[model samples]
Target: MPGQLTLQGKVSAGVESGCLVMESGGKQYLLVGGDPAVVKPGAEVEVRGVLKPDLASFCQQGEPLEVSSAKGR
Candidate 1:
């Protein structure tokens, strides 16, 4: 994890099939390891995680976010 980011933005529909997405600093991050049901669309949130490039998934949405923790603000 070379590029870790502490991002805060509104949760939105992920480009992937069923993933939570956050847009911050003009970048889109696909959040993994979180309950999709718990995160609402357009809800403001802060996510602490790292950008993982090698991680592959069904949801090839944007940058894969290896989320350590995420919470609504």
Candidate 2:
């Protein structure tokens, strides 16, 4: 888990269809490839993931994050 990052933020609904996003360090990151139950808008979450910039995303809003796991904070 050395490269894994733990990010804490409030989930927000992305402008695009079916996208979930979170803001941390003044930057927006698109959350993907995780449990739908955890990746939700308006939920405070501590997300553990890696920056998957190459990950194909429908949202096209923020940098894509390949979620390893996520839980409510």
TM-score of each: 0.77, 0.89
Stretches off by above 4 angstroms in model 2 are: none
Clashing pairs in 1: none
Task: For residues 1-73, write the lDDT of model 2, one tens digit per residue.
Answer: 6678889999999999789999998999999878888889888999999998787877978898889998998
Q: Report how far off residue 5 is in candidate 1 (Å).
A: 1.9
Best by lDDT: 2
Candidate 2, residue 22: how far the Cα is off, in Å: 0.3
State in Å the error of residue 62, model 1.
Answer: 1.1
lDDT of each: 0.77, 0.88
